[model samples]
Target: MARRLCGEGLGTMLLLAAIVGSGIMAERLAGGNDALALLGNTLPTGAMLAVLILIFAPVSGAHFNPAVSLCLALRGDFPWRLLIPYTAVQIAGAIAGAWIAHLMFELPVLQLSVTARTGSGQWIAEAVATFGLVLTILGASARRPDAVPFLVGLYIAAAYWFTASTSFANPAVTVARMLSDTFAGIRPIDAPAFIAAQLLGALAGLAASRLLFSPDAKPVAG
Candidate 1:
């Protein structure tokens, strides 16, 4: 249990660090308009997620997102005892990661206005983005665990491009990103709506996954 918790904490830390750090670098140090800088940010995020999954999936199932953990629990894959601690740790790790990014950039992230989508259209975008994320995770993990990391990375990358909200799927990430004044932050006022959309999208994804992928399906070994 200790090992699992540690793995969860570490993975969540790495995930948030990648997100907050990249956003800071892109918006603050790089002047926010460079396409290459944006790419630089996304590349590392993908790499980090892949690495974290490879490292921790066996131990903690690599549920760095509270939504994902909750969904898995609802699906009967994870125990109820794990829900609260996993969420708390993930949030703490995200906040710590945001703080680290602030230190790295030597900027006051809290004072900066959040950068995220707003309005009904934006809310729709968030739903679609999160729905894709959750669906991909469920599909890959349920039927093809070996492809989990790659599929997740690919799904996120695609969602970032296709979705207007840029795919801020994880609630912990959405909250942490709001703390930064960089391109990644969402205004606190905008957060609840996005989170609600994400949770609804996750439930939708769960239903979709059940229709598409059966629990008894065999995963191909890499």
Candidate 2:
């Protein structure tokens, strides 16, 4: 149990570091080209997600997102008793990772993002982003357990381009990003709506999965 928690924490931390750190680097190097910066950030983030999931899946199911954990718990693929703890650690890990990224870049460790990312369109985008993420994850795991890591990575990479919100499908990631004032940050004031949308998206995804797969659906591989 302790080891599984550790895996969640470490995996989430590394995931956030990859996201925030790469965003900072991309912003610094993009020479004012937002698209190019996003591209640079997206590639490394997706790559790191695949690597981290592959590394930790065997131990803790590699759920670095609260939305994913919640969805799995609802599906009975994850133990209900561990749901809260998993979410707690993932959030803590995300915050820690954000601070670590700031430290690495010699920026202030404590900062609230000012990048106002509100509005209905953004909220809807988050819902669609998270819905697609969970859907892809569950669908791929049911049919091709061996390919979950690559499938999730690919989905996120594509979502980054297609979604208006740049696919912040993870609640933990959304909260942690509020602490970063970088290219990937979202304003702290707008975090709640994003979180709400993500949770709703999770539920929608779970429903869709249930409708499409059997009650004894193939358990999702980490």
By lDDT, who's the top model here? 2
lDDT of each residue in 1-222, candidate 1, tens digit only: 788888888788888888778866665556556665666677778778888888889889998888899889999999999999999888888877887877777877455445656998778888888888889898887767899998887777667667777788888888888777776778888988999999998889888988778756565679
- RMSD per candidate (Å) reads 3.0, 3.3
Write one digit per residue (lDDT tens) for candidate 2, span 50-138: 99999999999998999999999988899999999999999999999999999999999999999999999899999999998899889
Q: lDDT for each of the candidates?
A: 0.81, 0.93
Scored by TM-score, the top model is 2
TM-score attained by model 1: 0.90
Q: What is the lDDT of residue 149 in candidate 1?
A: 90
lDDT of 1 at 105: 79
Clashing pairs in 1: 115-185
TM-score of each: 0.90, 0.96
Clashes of 2: 0
